[model samples]
Target: MIHSVANTDWQLASTAPLLRRGLCSLAQPLVSQTQRASRFVFAEPTIQLIVSGQLDLSTVHHHITMPASDALLFIQPHTCADIGNFRSIFLSISHSVVETLPRGFANTQTTQSISKSDSPFSTLALDADLSSALQYVISAIEDSQMSEARLRLRLQDLLMALAEKGNTFHNGNPETTTAKLRAMISEEPSKHWTAQSAGKALAMSPATLRRRLAEENTRFEHLLVDIRMHHAMMLFQTTNWHLSRIAEACGYRSTVRFNERFQERFGAVV
Candidate 1:
């Protein structure tokens, strides 16, 4: 089953079933929006299917692109990428999914194959087995009657198939407090977030939270605005909501203020 995003309903197509080992979502940019130098933190391994558009990404060491129908794989966790893209299908591999692989599942030669790559991510065409596996996952998503156990099995099959091609996701490093903060706020950007409130949510004192964020060279206020601005971009690209409504949804009551922040963050206007 594929999640659908339309121009006007405002659902934003965020309800793709997040299975234990995997999750799938469609990225259809209804508007012609191109973001520049946007930082993306990947908590887990992710693969993108360039269904009908291209994607350009820059990391610390590499810059790569995938044309239409090309597939890109990111095996490293706690990594970041700056992307420029439009239409694509993204599937994420859970850390535990790779951690649970049977012993001897990945041989030395196959492991070297990934290590030989200069970049954490690789680009390739979809093989027959992988294509079939993706289709099975989609079918399972559409079938609401599909059992959770069955879906997990299907996801395992898909990942195993990828492993056979020498592309395997590994367990990610522990997430930093900054990363954790971003994830928490992204879940509901419209919420009224303050240092004290966010600190409570993360089980830290407000002062401790501020200290941790400063150690990471960031501030609590910065992360909140960053998360909200990114959410605004998603809504702008995926939905047909007006600026005022989008601003409200992102915890802003004044459209002018929201526009000012967005312009400062992305250097663009909606």
Candidate 2:
């Protein structure tokens, strides 16, 4: 039998197999016009289903508009801004769960294919079959009486259904070189990042990095400023760190310069 437990922050439920792997499915109701933005660094990949309403997600390189009844793969860490109130179900897949799959499983193949793809993110429209399976998983997760073995079976079925939709998940090319570089820089915004230093970190020559970023309609200094400013905005919203501290954390030595740049980027005083 499936079981559900309610909590203050979210409606939480689990399957035995998934629980053993430290994965719990969650559903949350979003209020209309409630905007939330955060930086996410996922330790493992996740599959997110929009159960109701619509939301927009923005990364440094991609802006995705997810409508209701759609599914998207979040394979790496990025910043997400929810555009409006929307309800969502999140299936947090652990690394161990992937290891447990059979070598020849199509889900395994899909995972491998995605890892090899140029971009780590993709979205797919759920067909009738996949949609039905997702609804089942969502129901089973919310049902408190659902047994671990049964939930595991349901989860397996969902994976199989996804595999049947060949190339459904591998729907996009890899991110551009500049995007990758920007992700790296975002990971450590406090670092003293320069064209030469960033290029060295990405195993490219400084000149090549500059040229490629230019090809992507960005310059090194511009990209660096954008990254730093984004993080600064995040800090300002989420933390009470003083201006000097925030500036230092964003790799700015001069508070005056940091404030000037912040104002220019955000069109307001920091």
Candidate 3:
């Protein structure tokens, strides 16, 4: 039966699963704007769904802009990055979480029009129930007692709920104009890359690119920002490089611009 829940934070109940194969895990609201700028890097891949506000991301050749009602995914770890200005609440899971994904939901979708390869890993966003499930898990965590076993069980429930939601999200909307836009963003995410470059590469005229992206509920600059933010985060979490060096590696011509962009995108990095 579904457990009635309230907003709360709890110490996990179990360590058995964690001990068997400990997975790095940390889930919290993006703490501060500067942590947003910090080089505090993650040791593995992570994904976040913004419940509110805007987020900026930078990557190899592009920048990504992430808005509310949308999700941001990071598949691999990179060096040097920052989070832009935006107050957002999100959940983060480590690389190991991918192992728990159901089999049929795991393949890459290749039919994207603008982006020839790679797209939002999720073919469809989770349903309202899934969103509620996640919210419940966080709330449950807060209310859970300090028993280790109980904590593990709660976490398992959370993970299972998400997987179920993902399956539903995928089957419900196998096609969307937004899917094409997200796929394109996944492919290149360039800040300097304009709508023109995007259209030319996709074989659409400038006007058509604008129209198509709008129809999908997005803009070119936003996608570029999301791309950049994702890349920057990879660098921040995985590398031992200095902040300035990392920023340079991510494409900022100057450290100052990188810092500003990082906070502008992710908020103080924690």
Best by lDDT: 1
**lDDT tens digits, residues 170-198, model 2?**
32224577667765776678898988998
Model 3 error, position 98 (Å): 4.2
lDDT of 1 at 52: 53
lDDT of 2 at 37: 41
Model 1 spans > 4 angstroms off: 2-26, 30-37, 40-43, 70-79, 93-104, 112-118, 139-153
Model 3 C-alpha lDDT versus the unseen true structure: 0.46
Model 2 — TM-score against the truth?
Answer: 0.48
lDDT of 2: 0.60
lDDT of 2 at 16: 16
Q: Candidate 3: misplaced stretches above 4 Å?
A: 1-40, 70-80, 95-126, 144-270
Question: lDDT of each prediction vs. the true structure?
Answer: 0.68, 0.60, 0.46
Q: Please, what's the RMSD in Å of model 2?
A: 9.8
Q: Pick the winner on TM-score between candidates 1 and 2.
A: 1
The sequence of per-residue lDDT tens digits that candidate 3 reaches over residues 1-270 is 123222122122331111112323333233233344543332233445553456666544445666655343432332234456443333334333435445544234421221342332332354556546555545544443535455455555555554443321122112444444444444343334677876886778889988877877778766565556655665454344687766655556677777777677766432
